[model samples]
Target chain A: MPTLYIDLMSQPSRACYILCKKHGLPVDVQMIRLDKGEHKKPAYLQINPLGKVPFLVDGDLRLPESAAIMAYLCDKYSLPDNWHPGSSSSSGQAAAHQQQQEQQRRAVYESAVHWQHLNIRAGCMRLVFHTVIGPRVFKVPAVPQVAADGLKVLQQALKDMESYWLGGGSRPFLTGQQVSTPDLLCVCDLEQLRMMVAEPSQPQLEQLLAPHPIVRQWMAAVRAAVGPALYDEAHGKLAAAVARLAAAAAAKPAARL
Target chain B: MPTLYIDLMSQPSRACYILCKKHGLPVDVQMIRLDKGEHKKPAYLQINPLGKVPFLVDGDLRLPESAAIMAYLCDKYSLPDNWHPGSSSSSGQAAAHQQQQEQQRRAVYESAVHWQHLNIRAGCMRLVFHTVIGPRVFKVPAVPQVAADGLKVLQQALKDMESYWLGGGSRPFLTGQQVSTPDLLCVCDLEQLRMMVAEPSQPQLEQLLAPHPIVRQWMAAVRAAVGPALYDEAHGKLAAAVARLAAAAAAKPAARL
Candidate 1:
């Protein structure tokens, strides 16, 4: 059995949590509350020097980064053949070609995952921080210029997702007909954005996603695939945190002054 | 044979070039010159809409990003078993565990590759641009503040690499005893810095690498493994470009005015 140290409010943590549930991998889920500054403490720092969420401890190996954790689980558990086609046991030239194609698919998946770190993940986190988190949690007033810049980057990323990655052909996901790791990773980032924008206090954030129909449809599909029970279970803490922030913001307007 | 579109000056492009040479993969090297604004031109833009170097064009697959290109080559060519342990043919729990460890190794590789995009790569690029490129190529004076900031970030990344990733092990390379793709990628970025710092005009840049003996030794090992002829061949264009830039800077004394 492995122990996963995670904070539900973190986008990658939610992705890893949902991935484990979706695959039926039984493991201990240890919550590290980010809002309570639990992740920054010395105990957590000893576990991960970076003090980040989505760290995995299995036997002798301790791993951080959600992408790595997801890959480890897929390999260690040998979960279904569709998740990674290269893992399939087949031979011949046709098999070779299939393996090549699967490798290409994985390359694309890896590229997107890597690109998301600076683009989607960074942009969304900045946007959320500037518009909501900074003001609500830290009592720092919103910086409209920074928020707008973040929104612009997010919009371009959404457009790229549609035109370059997903909009090609009739494939339902980032890689193919099946829901792969990249899809799960991407959807969780967008869900974080969706959570922030759903708040009545942030109408400007809502308009950023309004023109991207493809992004909207893809999010809905990912949500349905994860299933409501698991999706809610994974995202429930984040939702509660957002609600608390909103209530706190409403309660003390003078704190900003 | 696949066509690899690259600019040798670009760090990732250099990695892919060296990897292909090391593996003896027959590839048509097509240079997209960034110094001449060739990458930004319409012809190159059609090949890669992102207008980035290190794009790979195999029969039908047009892949961008060095990590993706490297993985595809490793898969399609079916190179040595050590390059990618998970791709090896084996059976049972021990094999499964080996595969798991390999995947974990790869995950760390992936995490570093992704982190480099924003940290080492971005920081080094900014440092180079602010200290060298801006003044020489663009005729723009270096802003001390921006250059200092970039230097600070680069120094911190090098420290983290030593303390967190490398200091834990006696392994020669990033993953293990064998040289892996992540090693190629990281070494190339460091090589870019080395090229810039080697110049007589950039004493500050040279000082940055002086304290890190581990990084220096690891770099020497990677260069030796890559061998002299192939390594120099891959980096020749970039070296020449840097020289020309330096000569041009000397020629135009009053450009800053």
Candidate 2:
């Protein structure tokens, strides 16, 4: 059995968790508490020099980066053809043509993952941190300019997601009819924004998500695809943490007086 | 044969060129001149809305992102087993174990490619643009603070590449003894910094490269792996462009007088 070291609060970690559960891969889930700073400690650093979350240890192999982990799992388990159709078990020109289409789909997914890293992932994470998490959880004051900048970039990404990727027609997901890993990675990031907006301290974040109907529809579809039980299980820690932070923020005025 | 829309000045474009030529894949290289803004034009924009270089068109499929392009080429051509050993033609536990090791190697390579995008690629591109390209080509004066910050980040990336990834001892390439696609991508970016340092105007850039002997050694190995004639063919345009820029920079003072 493989060991997966993860903290559910991290988007990539959550994605990896869902991917494993979705496929029914037998593995030990070792929770590395981020709040306890376990990930930054020397023990964790020894395993991964970068000391980042969602690393997989299978036999002698220690792998980090959610994209890499997901790709490896998809190959190792030989999961459904839809996940990575390029490696489909077929032959001849028909197979070659199918492989070409699959490669194109894979390329689009790869491009989205890379683009998400610099844009949506970075933008939404920063916005959530500056608006809600930094102030409420960490007790650090929010930087308005930085937060505003994050919101701006997030808005642009959402618009692009809706108009460019999703608006192409009746596609249920980012790539096509089938849900892929990039969809998993993307929806996780969007969930961060959704979580922050759910907090009572930041009603403004809701307005940021209000305009994009396509985003809402796609996110709902992702939720449905993941199923309610696993979705809740993956996000349970994060939801609870946000609730606790919101409650504390609400009680702060009474304590001050 | 597939048509590759590229500009040699772009690092990823050069990587794609080298990968195809190195593997002996049939490709029609259609050079898109960035200086003339060919990529931004309506015709190219219709093909790739993102308007980025190093995109591939094979029949109806339009693939972007160099990493994906390289992976697709590797799969479509079935160049070598080592290039993507995870997708080997075998089965059962023994094959699964071998696949596991191959996937681990692939994961490391994937992680490196993603890490390279944000760190080395972004940092070095910004550093060279601010310190060299912006001032020389665009007639925009260099921002000392921005250039300094870029140099700082790039130096840190170089140190990490040397000590963390390459320092494991006596490896001919990044992932292993054999040079992979990620190696091609990484070497191209380092070559950009190398090109800038070669310019008489930017002697300071040389200092950034001087401290890392491991980087130098790895780069040499990558060059050797690609072979001289093919390597020279791939880099010919970029070299000429750099030379032209250097000559133009040298002649500017005389013109002003």
Which predicted model would earn the best lDDT? 2
- The whole-model lDDT of each prediction reads 0.72, 0.74
Tens-place lDDT per residue, model 1, B1-257, is 89999988888999999988888899998988887889879999888876788999988788877877887787677777555544443444456556666666666665655556656765676677667777765577765544554566678877766666665447676666777777787778776765464244654434766887777777777788888788888889877876675676566656776
Model 1 alpha-carbon drift over 4 Å, by segment: A87-94, A129-153, A194-204, A246-257, B88-108, B126-153, B194-204, B244-257
Tell me, by DockQ, which candidate is best.
1
RMSD (CA, angstroms), candidate 1: 4.2
- Mark the 10 consecutive residues where model 2 chain B has the least summed lDDT: B84-93
lDDT digits (tens) for residues A157-192 of candidate 1:
777777666754356777667777777777777767
Task: Please give the range of 10 consecutive residues that has the lowest summed lDDT in model 1 chain A.
Answer: A84-93
Residues B124-212 of candidate 2 have per-residue lDDT tens digits of 77677777777655577766544554576688788777876675446666667787877788788877764574345554545776888
**Model 2 spans > 4 angstroms off:** A86-111, A125-156, A167-169, A194-205, A244-257, B86-97, B126-153, B194-205, B240-257
Candidate 1 to truth, TM: 0.84
